[model samples]
Target: MSALKESQHLKIPLKDIEIATNNFQHCIGIGGYGNVYKGELLIHGKSTIVAVKRLNEQFGQGLKEFLTEIQLLSGQNHPNLISLLGYCDEGKEKIIVYEYAANGSLDQYLRRGSNVPALTWMERLIICVDAARGLNHLHHEVGKHQTIIHRDIKSSNILIDNNWVAKISDLGLSKLGLSGLNRSAVISRVCGTPGYCEPEYFSTGIVTKESDVYSFGIVLFEVLCGKLCCTVDHDGFQLSATVVKDYYKKKKVSEIVDPILKEQMSSELIRDFSKIAYRCLHEDRDQRPPMTLVVKKLERLLAIQDVLLKAAESTLSDVIKPAHPLVREGGNASEIPLDISVLSNMRDFVKYNRLKQFALRALASTLDEDELWHLKDQFYAIDVDKNGAISLEEMRDAFAKDLPWKLKETRVLEILKAIDSNADGLVDFTDFVAATLNVYQLEGQDSERWQILSQAAFEKFDVDRDGYITPEDIRMHTGLKGSIDLLLKEADIDKDCKISLSDFCRLLGT
Candidate 1:
């Protein structure tokens, strides 16, 4: 685009596209710009599979966009961003060819009741991270001084390759910010998908990286909740982002999310994942974290889930079998050794169900302060991020205000046994940790009352199965006063001392 000589190299002969597409006999998809066809083209000397988009001027105002796409993609190249191999500007025929996505667009799989297998929680997290990284490159690292804004960011535009790596595609609406990436630039007109676009960018003609952040946020929720942001009702009325925002703010998102997802993931992972997505939708764009920060948080979350999964598959006996009465640092007292089953379940943590959480709290209380304090340092040292998640200070503030409501993993006691070589009760943090469990195992001795039980992750880790979760049960389950208060307040919403599944799911956002 900058030089005619350089641009001419990307020109593909019309005959090649015709040969690749079998004379335009099979159409894979239809779009605003034109019809998308799947085909194979021989480049240099070898044949390569590709997706071909042919320009249909009478179909939509794509002439300008098509030229813009060729201009922009002609200069950009990244793994996460789609690659534009070449273009065909032979007379009236205008077409672009790029690598084919075997898995198709992400939206096809995200829609509910679809025939495609649902993506696991881990897969969704990875896809989001990939998409975020691509956007980050576009917003910050594309050129020495240039910043590009992806004017149209949505679920459908994200393509998943055969390996399931997400790729950001369709940048026809993208803009090259004349100003640096650090600042927002004014645009002549507002354009983008309605529900995915930000209010500020839509109302004012000012566009920034934050605008893409907003749209990406909506996509994140769509991935998490497994539903589109803008859904048409029977009356053709579209439910905007505000409705989703209201659902999140009210903690009623659990009712709308895929119950299977909530049931499969831990409450801690769900809360933390949702928190990042929610911040991106903040009314004040400045409050939204930069793409780099979002990438860090999301990657961290994904890592935590991966670790938790590995540990869940391991047993306490599989690792080190420490003797009972494990003394605390600088304090020696003969006490009952922690239940091995409880320790085993701790490894699984959020990988299975929230039941792991109940077992965690129960172990804390069953073992006196002396025993619990022994693992405090190891617990806080799970990651170098101080709290391994949202800032510890920010996390404490959230729990303080939304107490008993957002008692996140900050208090969940992520355990890895940090096994010290000195035979002392201490953690080393990087000792090749690995463990797992069936999660559905027998409990402690009959009279022991504190054994870990293999139960539901989302709910019902009924250590004491009278079919009800009471104050005594709560106190014994999770020892922290904050968690006890949050769970009790949330569970016993009727104040009748009864825990309602509905009320608890609302608080968990699972």
Candidate 2:
């Protein structure tokens, strides 16, 4: 009590907390600390909502944790971490207050009950990313001057704000790690929610930052599988770490994923995320990547040849069309003429949607020798400097003789924007090949080689194999940015925000 009072913590009177929580009538939950209530406080004449946790003596075990929580968290500040506001220690009443999390605890949402909205694969990843960030800060930069191990890292402790951002909460069981190191401390007792605790930590009573890593790995699997750890199946088959390890070892981890989330996840996203997550649960604690490496791996898991994770989260498009997709006039394969003029190709290129550009960009990177025969010559012809990349000057000079009208400077930049992969100033081979590839050719479709190349290109771009090409899909598998809206505006004819194989054929046929 003296320690709390001497510090700058807001020491609210018991009467105020009682009034704020309507005389303890608004009990919202039974927390690890005690009964939790939702309430509003008058701060500077404004009614600010807060969560009030009043310690129950019958539980009688958390007085140490209550003080430790106050001591460790009073000076901490992080967006991913929950903030402590005030405390009440008047007589037997020991209460702690926190900022309200509108979305409630994550455990309620994981099961996807009738009342709660299902979390998408992307949302789950973002939440894990948030939790990881919080863990990283706790491990390295806590104001407590100690390496912290959040002994009770669990999904229930992860609170989601109204904005859908996740914040780590409930530090009552957290322990100070080694004096100068973030490694193992051979404590006399084992603590933590059983299923989430690491075998090494539990068996040997040794705890470290890696112990928290092990717990977080359980949370990751919870996000992936949408279940509480060690849950028993209908047949009483327990989905324990051993079960998960077996599934992982057999490469059948997907079989256990929550059915609701299964469709939302792309196969590659699942594979990469699972690999990183399972590594966190390694039996050898030394093998687990530190929180920093975990963050980096999670963030970088989905970047492409520049369809950014940011773009998938927010920005861009991918599409592959044959340089010469044959026009079927009376369905004849040999009679249709292939487009050969750069001016005509450039003019048609202007007609493309961002989705189309995205697909072709990915396609260009993987195009076969047969597909590139004509476009390859055109690329070399424009590369007079022989630098293997096309400068804006090369572009202007190549079409300088052919355009019946003066090429608008904007048109040149637009062409570059159309083909620009990675957003670098000059057009590389991939960009140039993608842009000049004619979208109009009917005779080429009958060629087994062209058909196979087309199929192969689609497979390359659609890394998730979801059939439809979405902005998120392109963002994850391919790498391009800027002008996604412009691309979709023209290319996504149905306005469904994704592209399909028939859509590709239909647009090229036009």
Candidate 3:
């Protein structure tokens, strides 16, 4: 009987990752979820900056959750949801590439005070609305499938980009069900950030949409107060237990408002938010409003705020000619294209074009040329040690002997596996020759087998048409399975932030 096999996933090679990240030198942040590093990935010859979330090698959550999470996230598309690019599913090494958010986590602004001066109240209110909309999409806007519940909702889980748009991140501990009520309910080993967890779920094992509301309530309180939930009175009153508890009790709204806001906040807005917060913290799970209601209310609030702000701005400003040439009133930023001629001389481009043309011409030159087989031999002539064997070890030594860093043994093994057809331990001269010949002379065979599967996976994962897979895409496509990052790392042959056609073929292989 055949043993059950894990589904194959796309992987990013490690070498490409090294070049993009400058050897992981520009890591901007680290968290319980994972270490986040900065990198640039090339998609269709265009370089785009991305954030690389590297799951901790030793974290059990990292090992169990990387792939499942990526697949789920990849298939989902909503204005509220973060976009998943393509992904890399190498063997045993997992990494997720994402669109970099320059403004970083909401927690950073709230806790660090570094960018706090810039976060106006209007921006904060908008952030809350944006977050609620994303949650609403997960709960109701997604296609005819089960609803999703973000088990962990906290300030840190919300990310902001350069434009100050808020997005929910870290789907590692989420669950699937319509309002957390379904026959096919999903339950995991109890996991969630403390203080944000619902008391019922924390005490019992049952997870429900009410649990998510409880967490969202915590986030709402945090956003209003700019404070973290603490067990002890590190700041004052331990907001999680005191004000949060009081709000739950008799709607003691004023007690829970962040003391830091003293006189700066609007009383009416605070009162409105306080009422919503109380509703969110309802003791009876059934009484709590769904994400849909929450999102709708938040949108109405934002609309009112926008009208008021625009009217206020209109009164203070006088029209003047635009000072910044590139700052069009309603246009988006354009990409500054890199000229390829900068890297190649006229002679090189001509030589490259000529070789490609010659290759194409050779394909139709002769239908039955023994020259195809001979050319295969020329490709494998690197086995000059005369061992009649092209061991992966031999290949690695040949290629990396002059390089500065240690070449990974696993990568060489993957390359060997690609060339070795019979699951053989070694790649003999014949095997290498056959592999080379297949690439050049096997055009006669129908290309549909590889092309169709490849295109499907690419289209499924490449949401941005950037021609590169990202962790977000992997999660969306795989139905929100966790451990996607780990799977990508294992499948990545070269440690690059991409899974090429060659890598895709390996995953598709039986």
lDDT of 1 by residue, 434-495 (tens): 12121111121122322321124223334566556666665554343534544555345567
Q: Give model 1's TM-score versus the native structure.
A: 0.64
Q: How does residue 84 of candidate 2 score in lDDT?
A: 86
> Per-residue alpha-carbon lDDT of model 2 for 1-510, expressed as tens digits?
554866444788899999999899988889766998999987657788999998987776679778878876777889899888888888888999888899988888875343788787777877888889999888877755567788989999999988988899888887867534445667786778889998887778878998888888888888888777776655565656777778877888888888887766556456667777788889988677778767755654322212223334532222111233334457332233333344445555666665566666655666668767666565666677778888888777654433232367778777766666677778888777777664323113344555555666666656788887777666666556644666555546678987776565444433
What lDDT does each candidate get?
Answer: 0.64, 0.71, 0.58
Poorest 10 consecutive residues of model 1 by lDDT?
A: 432-441
Given candidate 3, what's the lDDT at residue 421?
42
Estimate the TM-score of every prediction.
Answer: 0.64, 0.63, 0.56
Please give the lDDT score at residue 96 for candidate 1.
90
**What is the lDDT for 262 in model 2?**
70
Off by over 4 Å in 1: 1-5, 178-181, 232-239, 316-510
Cα error, residue 212 of model 3, in Å, equals: 1.3
- For candidate 2, give the lDDT: 0.71
